[model samples]
Target: MPIGVVKTERSIVGVACLIHKDWTLRDEKIMVVNLNIGSELLCLVIANGPNENERAEIQDEFYEALQRELDKVKGKFILLGDLNGR
Candidate 1:
Protein backbone atom coordinates (compact mmCIF):
# COMPACT_ATOMS: atom_id res chain seq x y z
CA MET A 1 0.00 0.00 0.00
CA PRO A 2 1.03 3.61 -0.49
CA ILE A 3 2.44 5.44 2.50
CA GLY A 4 2.69 9.05 3.62
CA VAL A 5 4.30 10.96 6.47
CA VAL A 6 3.92 8.26 9.09
CA LYS A 7 5.53 9.31 12.32
CA THR A 8 5.72 8.02 15.87
CA GLU A 9 6.27 10.16 18.98
CA ARG A 10 7.54 9.14 22.41
CA SER A 11 10.90 8.82 24.11
CA ILE A 12 11.99 8.02 20.51
CA VAL A 13 10.28 10.17 17.95
CA GLY A 14 10.73 10.24 14.12
CA VAL A 15 9.08 9.77 10.79
CA ALA A 16 8.27 6.08 10.49
CA CYS A 17 8.22 6.38 6.72
CA LEU A 18 7.61 8.84 3.92
CA ILE A 19 6.02 6.75 1.21
CA HIS A 20 5.01 8.90 -1.70
CA LYS A 21 3.05 5.98 -3.13
CA ASP A 22 3.99 2.68 -1.45
CA TRP A 23 4.59 0.94 1.85
CA THR A 24 6.73 -2.03 2.79
CA LEU A 25 8.31 -2.21 6.25
CA ARG A 26 8.36 -0.24 9.53
CA ASP A 27 8.75 -0.81 13.26
CA GLU A 28 10.08 0.85 16.43
CA LYS A 29 13.54 2.22 15.46
CA ILE A 30 13.20 0.90 11.93
CA MET A 31 12.29 3.92 9.75
CA VAL A 32 11.70 3.39 6.05
CA VAL A 33 12.44 6.65 4.28
CA ASN A 34 11.48 5.24 0.93
CA LEU A 35 9.89 1.86 0.69
CA ASN A 36 10.77 1.42 -2.96
CA ILE A 37 12.89 3.32 -5.42
CA GLY A 38 12.61 1.54 -8.73
CA SER A 39 14.43 -1.40 -7.13
CA GLU A 40 16.14 0.02 -4.07
CA LEU A 41 15.04 1.26 -0.63
CA LEU A 42 16.39 3.61 2.01
CA CYS A 43 16.05 3.23 5.76
CA LEU A 44 17.31 5.09 8.81
CA VAL A 45 17.91 2.68 11.62
CA ILE A 46 17.76 4.32 15.04
CA ALA A 47 18.80 2.55 18.18
CA ASN A 48 19.35 5.35 20.67
CA GLY A 49 16.23 6.89 19.17
CA PRO A 50 16.99 10.61 19.51
CA ASN A 51 19.55 13.03 20.88
CA GLU A 52 17.10 14.57 23.37
CA ASN A 53 17.39 11.64 25.75
CA GLU A 54 19.61 13.81 28.02
CA ARG A 55 20.85 10.69 29.73
CA ALA A 56 24.60 10.06 29.80
CA GLU A 57 24.20 6.30 29.75
CA ILE A 58 23.15 4.87 26.40
CA GLN A 59 25.64 2.91 24.44
CA ASP A 60 25.51 -0.85 24.72
CA GLU A 61 21.76 -0.98 24.29
CA PHE A 62 21.85 1.54 21.48
CA TYR A 63 24.53 -0.24 19.49
CA GLU A 64 22.94 -3.60 20.04
CA ALA A 65 19.57 -2.33 18.89
CA LEU A 66 21.12 -0.62 15.90
CA GLN A 67 22.83 -3.79 14.76
CA ARG A 68 19.61 -5.73 15.21
CA GLU A 69 17.57 -3.31 13.09
CA LEU A 70 20.22 -3.15 10.38
CA ASP A 71 20.07 -6.90 10.05
CA LYS A 72 16.39 -6.64 9.22
CA VAL A 73 17.04 -4.57 6.13
CA LYS A 74 16.85 -6.67 2.98
CA GLY A 75 19.06 -5.20 0.26
CA LYS A 76 19.90 -1.46 0.38
CA PHE A 77 19.73 1.03 3.31
CA ILE A 78 21.49 3.74 5.27
CA LEU A 79 22.04 4.47 9.00
CA LEU A 80 22.13 7.96 10.52
CA GLY A 81 23.06 9.12 14.06
CA ASP A 82 25.81 10.64 16.13
CA LEU A 83 27.79 8.13 18.12
CA ASN A 84 30.65 9.98 19.86
CA GLY A 85 28.83 13.29 19.56
CA ARG A 86 26.12 11.87 21.80
Candidate 2:
Protein backbone atom coordinates (compact mmCIF):
# COMPACT_ATOMS: atom_id res chain seq x y z
CA MET A 1 0.00 0.00 0.00
CA PRO A 2 1.83 3.06 -1.31
CA ILE A 3 0.08 6.14 0.01
CA GLY A 4 1.03 9.49 -1.49
CA VAL A 5 -0.11 12.95 -0.36
CA VAL A 6 -0.02 16.31 -2.11
CA LYS A 7 -0.85 19.85 -1.00
CA THR A 8 -1.99 22.71 -3.15
CA GLU A 9 -2.58 26.43 -2.61
CA ARG A 10 -6.20 25.62 -1.92
CA SER A 11 -6.33 21.81 -2.35
CA ILE A 12 -4.44 18.62 -1.77
CA VAL A 13 -4.65 15.33 -3.79
CA GLY A 14 -2.64 12.17 -4.18
CA VAL A 15 -2.76 8.40 -4.76
CA ALA A 16 -2.05 5.40 -2.57
CA CYS A 17 -1.89 1.60 -2.43
CA LEU A 18 -1.28 0.29 -5.91
CA ILE A 19 -2.17 -3.31 -5.25
CA HIS A 20 -1.92 -5.51 -8.29
CA LYS A 21 -4.42 -8.34 -8.76
CA ASP A 22 -2.80 -11.47 -9.97
CA TRP A 23 -2.35 -15.07 -9.11
CA THR A 24 1.19 -14.30 -8.09
CA LEU A 25 0.46 -10.73 -6.97
CA ARG A 26 1.95 -9.35 -10.15
CA ASP A 27 -0.62 -6.84 -11.43
CA GLU A 28 -2.86 -4.92 -9.03
CA LYS A 29 -3.06 -1.21 -8.27
CA ILE A 30 -4.92 1.16 -5.95
CA MET A 31 -4.79 4.95 -5.69
CA VAL A 32 -6.08 7.47 -3.15
CA VAL A 33 -5.89 11.26 -3.34
CA ASN A 34 -6.88 14.03 -0.96
CA LEU A 35 -7.61 17.59 -1.88
CA ASN A 36 -8.15 20.69 0.26
CA ILE A 37 -9.57 23.65 -1.56
CA GLY A 38 -9.73 26.77 0.52
CA SER A 39 -11.73 25.67 3.55
CA GLU A 40 -13.06 22.53 1.85
CA LEU A 41 -11.52 19.09 1.71
CA LEU A 42 -11.98 16.37 -0.91
CA CYS A 43 -10.63 12.89 -1.45
CA LEU A 44 -10.53 10.68 -4.56
CA VAL A 45 -9.58 7.02 -4.59
CA ILE A 46 -8.97 4.74 -7.57
CA ALA A 47 -8.66 1.04 -7.01
CA ASN A 48 -8.03 -1.92 -9.26
CA GLY A 49 -9.76 -5.14 -8.45
CA PRO A 50 -10.60 -8.42 -10.07
CA ASN A 51 -12.52 -9.33 -6.94
CA GLU A 52 -15.76 -7.45 -6.40
CA ASN A 53 -16.25 -8.65 -2.83
CA GLU A 54 -12.84 -7.63 -1.70
CA ARG A 55 -13.12 -4.35 -3.53
CA ALA A 56 -16.37 -3.54 -1.80
CA GLU A 57 -14.91 -4.30 1.59
CA ILE A 58 -11.84 -2.21 0.97
CA GLN A 59 -13.89 0.67 -0.35
CA ASP A 60 -16.14 0.62 2.67
CA GLU A 61 -13.20 0.82 5.02
CA PHE A 62 -11.59 3.55 3.00
CA TYR A 63 -14.74 5.64 3.07
CA GLU A 64 -15.00 5.22 6.80
CA ALA A 65 -11.46 6.41 7.23
CA LEU A 66 -12.09 9.39 5.02
CA GLN A 67 -15.16 10.36 6.99
CA ARG A 68 -13.29 10.01 10.23
CA GLU A 69 -10.52 12.26 8.99
CA LEU A 70 -12.96 14.83 7.68
CA ASP A 71 -14.76 14.87 11.00
CA LYS A 72 -11.53 15.67 12.76
CA VAL A 73 -10.60 18.42 10.34
CA LYS A 74 -11.70 21.98 10.94
CA GLY A 75 -13.42 22.68 7.63
CA LYS A 76 -15.99 21.46 5.13
CA PHE A 77 -15.00 18.25 3.42
CA ILE A 78 -16.11 15.95 0.57
CA LEU A 79 -15.05 12.39 -0.03
CA LEU A 80 -15.26 10.51 -3.32
CA GLY A 81 -14.29 7.01 -4.36
CA ASP A 82 -15.19 4.17 -6.74
CA LEU A 83 -16.30 1.78 -4.06
CA ASN A 84 -17.83 -0.32 -6.87
CA GLY A 85 -20.49 -1.16 -4.35
CA ARG A 86 -23.14 -0.16 -6.80
Candidate 3:
Protein backbone atom coordinates (compact mmCIF):
# COMPACT_ATOMS: atom_id res chain seq x y z
CA MET A 1 0.00 0.00 0.00
CA PRO A 2 1.09 3.59 -0.52
CA ILE A 3 2.58 4.81 2.70
CA GLY A 4 1.72 8.44 2.24
CA VAL A 5 -1.64 9.65 1.00
CA VAL A 6 -3.24 12.80 -0.36
CA LYS A 7 -6.98 12.71 0.17
CA THR A 8 -8.92 15.03 -2.07
CA GLU A 9 -12.52 15.96 -2.44
CA ARG A 10 -14.69 13.76 -4.62
CA SER A 11 -14.78 16.43 -7.27
CA ILE A 12 -11.12 15.87 -8.18
CA VAL A 13 -11.10 12.16 -7.61
CA GLY A 14 -11.18 11.47 -11.33
CA VAL A 15 -7.60 12.74 -11.75
CA ALA A 16 -4.55 11.69 -9.80
CA CYS A 17 -1.15 10.06 -10.00
CA LEU A 18 0.82 7.63 -7.81
CA ILE A 19 4.42 8.66 -7.39
CA HIS A 20 7.41 8.43 -5.12
CA LYS A 21 6.11 5.32 -3.41
CA ASP A 22 9.32 4.92 -1.48
CA TRP A 23 9.43 8.65 -0.90
CA THR A 24 6.19 8.25 1.05
CA LEU A 25 7.51 6.49 4.14
CA ARG A 26 10.88 8.17 4.30
CA ASP A 27 9.41 11.65 4.19
CA GLU A 28 7.10 11.02 7.08
CA LYS A 29 4.24 9.85 4.86
CA ILE A 30 4.35 13.02 2.78
CA MET A 31 3.78 13.20 -0.97
CA VAL A 32 3.85 16.27 -3.18
CA VAL A 33 1.84 16.49 -6.37
CA ASN A 34 0.62 19.05 -8.85
CA LEU A 35 -3.14 19.43 -8.67
CA ASN A 36 -3.99 21.24 -11.87
CA ILE A 37 -7.57 21.99 -11.02
CA GLY A 38 -8.37 25.44 -9.70
CA SER A 39 -4.98 25.30 -8.01
CA GLU A 40 -1.65 23.91 -9.15
CA LEU A 41 -0.29 22.98 -5.75
CA LEU A 42 -1.08 19.95 -3.64
CA CYS A 43 0.41 17.36 -1.34
CA LEU A 44 -0.62 13.84 -0.22
CA VAL A 45 0.00 12.35 3.17
CA ILE A 46 -0.87 9.05 4.92
CA ALA A 47 -0.68 8.29 8.57
CA ASN A 48 0.38 4.98 10.02
CA GLY A 49 -1.05 3.06 12.91
CA PRO A 50 -0.39 4.31 16.40
CA ASN A 51 3.13 3.53 17.40
CA GLU A 52 4.61 3.39 20.84
CA ASN A 53 4.27 6.40 23.13
CA GLU A 54 0.58 6.40 22.23
CA ARG A 55 1.40 8.43 19.11
CA ALA A 56 2.98 7.96 15.75
CA GLU A 57 5.96 10.25 15.38
CA ILE A 58 6.14 9.86 11.61
CA GLN A 59 2.49 10.73 11.11
CA ASP A 60 2.76 13.67 13.46
CA GLU A 61 5.82 14.94 11.68
CA PHE A 62 4.13 14.59 8.28
CA TYR A 63 1.11 16.51 9.55
CA GLU A 64 3.39 19.31 10.64
CA ALA A 65 5.19 19.24 7.32
CA LEU A 66 1.93 19.36 5.42
CA GLN A 67 1.04 22.53 7.29
CA ARG A 68 4.30 24.13 6.17
CA GLU A 69 3.59 23.20 2.58
CA LEU A 70 0.11 24.60 2.80
CA ASP A 71 1.53 27.85 4.09
CA LYS A 72 3.73 28.05 1.05
CA VAL A 73 0.84 27.58 -1.34
CA LYS A 74 -1.32 30.17 0.39
CA GLY A 75 -4.26 29.60 -1.91
CA LYS A 76 -7.18 27.31 -2.54
CA PHE A 77 -5.60 23.91 -1.85
CA ILE A 78 -6.91 20.39 -1.42
CA LEU A 79 -5.82 18.64 1.71
CA LEU A 80 -5.85 14.96 0.79
CA GLY A 81 -4.56 12.30 3.12
CA ASP A 82 -5.44 9.25 5.16
CA LEU A 83 -5.34 8.87 8.89
CA ASN A 84 -5.40 5.57 10.79
CA GLY A 85 -7.06 6.27 14.11
CA ARG A 86 -7.40 2.62 14.88
Q: lDDT per model, in order?
A: 0.49, 0.41, 0.45
Best by lDDT: 1
lDDT of 1 by residue, 12-62 (tens): 333344346543345444343435567667655533253545464654555
Model 2: lDDT of residue 69: 49
lDDT of 3 at 32: 49
Error of 1 at 13 (Å): 7.7
Residue 73's lDDT within candidate 1 is: 75
> What's every prediction's RMSD, in angstroms?
5.9, 12.8, 9.4
**Model 2 alpha-carbon drift over 4 Å, by segment:** 1-51, 55-60
User: TM-score, each model?
Assistant: 0.47, 0.31, 0.42
lDDT of 3 by residue, 2-81 (tens): 23345543332122346634222334334445444453544443333233444567557746766666566544555565
- Between candidates 2 and 3, the one scoring higher on TM-score is 3
List ranges where model 3 is wrong by over 4 Å: 1-16, 19-28, 38-59
Error of 2 at 1 (Å): 14
Tell me which of candidates 1 and 2 scores higher on lDDT: 1
Ranking under lDDT, best-scoring first?
Answer: 1, 3, 2
Per-residue alpha-carbon lDDT of candidate 2 for residues 36-77, written as tens digits (9 for 90 to 100) = 557665544443332365666765765566555445545443
